[model samples]
Target: MNRAWRTVFIALLTAGVVGSAAWLVFVSPVLGVREVRVVGNLDVSAGQIRQATGVADGKPLATVDAAEIEDRVARIRRIESVRVSRGWPGTLMIEVVERTPVAVLPVGGTFALVDRHGVVIEIKGVVPPALPVLRLDRPGPGDPATAAALAVVGALPEELSSRVAEVHAPSAETVSLRLRDGRSVVWGGSDRAADKARVLVTLLKRPADTYDVSSPDVVTVK
Candidate 1:
């Protein structure tokens, strides 16, 4: 008799638990998102994010597609990666990873923001502060020269790079550097970038007028 009673109690308890879960999932629907929180956004604005998602407060939380939101965010240039999550009970979260702009090049009258990957990310209203101005005649979306330029920039010594205000690849025959300190560096080609960096460092110690590392082993002092 006691065994039968215990089994009945267990069945009742199971039913109650299932009913409560169903109520919470179907009737209550407390998992609906009410807000979206964004983080790590420097390029894309919150308004832009909301506009891209077409999701707003009061939208059904259960239907918030994180992957869809991420796809929309990816369409926006300068946003390298995006992640979305459901913040239960009233919030949807969108985290975006923005591509870092490495330099600014004058495309037309305005400046183009270029990333390390050599992709032009944006054209700003005004030139950003303290970024290198690349002046390659053939710097376009299709030019491998742009990638080479970025690689050269990446390889340059900090002291030399910070002193540089502009870089010019006149015809790919030579890569030139114009420094803020009234100096120039003739980095001939990208073949010996590290060696060129070292040579430039040594040349900088005395300061003639310019240091030519086009042939790093056989440097020219001007």
Candidate 2:
């Protein structure tokens, strides 16, 4: 019995030493990230992402929390979604999904980049020439006005999208369109959005200055 107890104690002591050594030598260093890989980024540079992430070359790979990296990267306004992962002993991988500018919103005198869902992603110095502006009052997330704006965006005809100057949501139920050609499209409300769009498209093909599609079936252009 004494011999058996001595053997067990020695085995336990040996395991503890081996575990500590492995943790100290292998796991501790791997806790810091040594390499970083950025993917799915455009307009924003890899260097910029790396800097924003604050993940340096010496960070322990195993110690790096994927959620922490994701949160850090997501702090940048242009990034919509991010994923972070560590590869084996030394590599840190970052995958980011960038937000594409869909429209511009008036921010005081300047403009802000709005996504297709009407999310104001970034405040910018100048509005991009290609994207149209969305003129809307401040609406919180999931507000009816925001829903109406998104509806109008979805209802817009592709042919007219480029020529649109702004989408005006003056009220929750009403939307008006300002065209690049100095014309207005009066869309009375969110009701029958697709119907209004179809009628508007047909009338746009004609030589008209102003269109009123408030009543979808009986649209008029002058």
Candidate 3:
């Protein structure tokens, strides 16, 4: 009401607003991260992901950079993709998708574990039994033949894949599989892979030295 009193009131109000802003931005206990949670990881351990994130405990959640954390986690060789988010109150969540190896390519003395995209995910002296060996004269991730063979391997149902010991791809047009029981499957190229897979699954029930799903509609057995 009075001019001096009004001035004092405005000054006090401004100080309170500034103080609240500072407390929220610089010193709020409720905004600090107390936990980091990891999800969707198979091969990668949760502790490894947490370490990769580089998010320090008790740091302000608002200051945590999701993009930076995701980029750091994505650097792991086995990780296919990652999503980092800040959970309200006191948690940071990280979700990771790891690359699944579908085949092994013998390169030099070591076998390179490759995913469906033909990207080499890992390498070791011995190939894993669950993965089929991929035979390519010159194996490159971007090679058409390698991609086609990988596509075929990726499409095979678990039952069918269990019986396949190796996949031979000399060229994009000549994709074939060698079964564990000594039968061969001529899979042709990557085209109509799902159809070929369906035909081959049914055709394998019969006895044959070689099964051709090269032209799945008109398959031949030898």
Q: Model 1 clash pairs?
A: 32-61, 33-61, 34-90, 34-91, 35-90, 35-92
Clash-forming residue pairs, model 3: none
Top of the candidates by lDDT? 3
Q: Write one digit per residue (lDDT tens) for candidate 3, span 59-95.
A: 8888888999999999998999999887887899998
Give me candidate 1's TM-score against the actual structure.
0.73
Ten contiguous residues minimizing lDDT sum, candidate 1: 25-34
lDDT of 2: 0.79
Residue-level lDDT of model 2, residues 1-222, one tens digit each, is 599999999999999999987786446764556778899998788998888787667655656678987998898878889998777667788899998877777878888777766667878898788887777677545667766776777667788778888888878777888899989998888788888887888888889788999898888888
What TM-score, to 2 decimals, does candidate 2 have?
Answer: 0.74
What is the lDDT, from 0 to 100, of the residue 86 in candidate 3?
75
Residues 29-77 of candidate 1: C-alpha lDDT, one tens digit per residue: 4655567788889757987877888785566677677788899888988
What are the runs in model 2 whose C-alpha is more than 4 Å off? Answer: 1-26, 30-32, 117-126, 139-147, 154-157, 188-199, 210-222
lDDT of each: 0.79, 0.79, 0.90
| Residue 9 accuracy (lDDT) in model 1 | 96
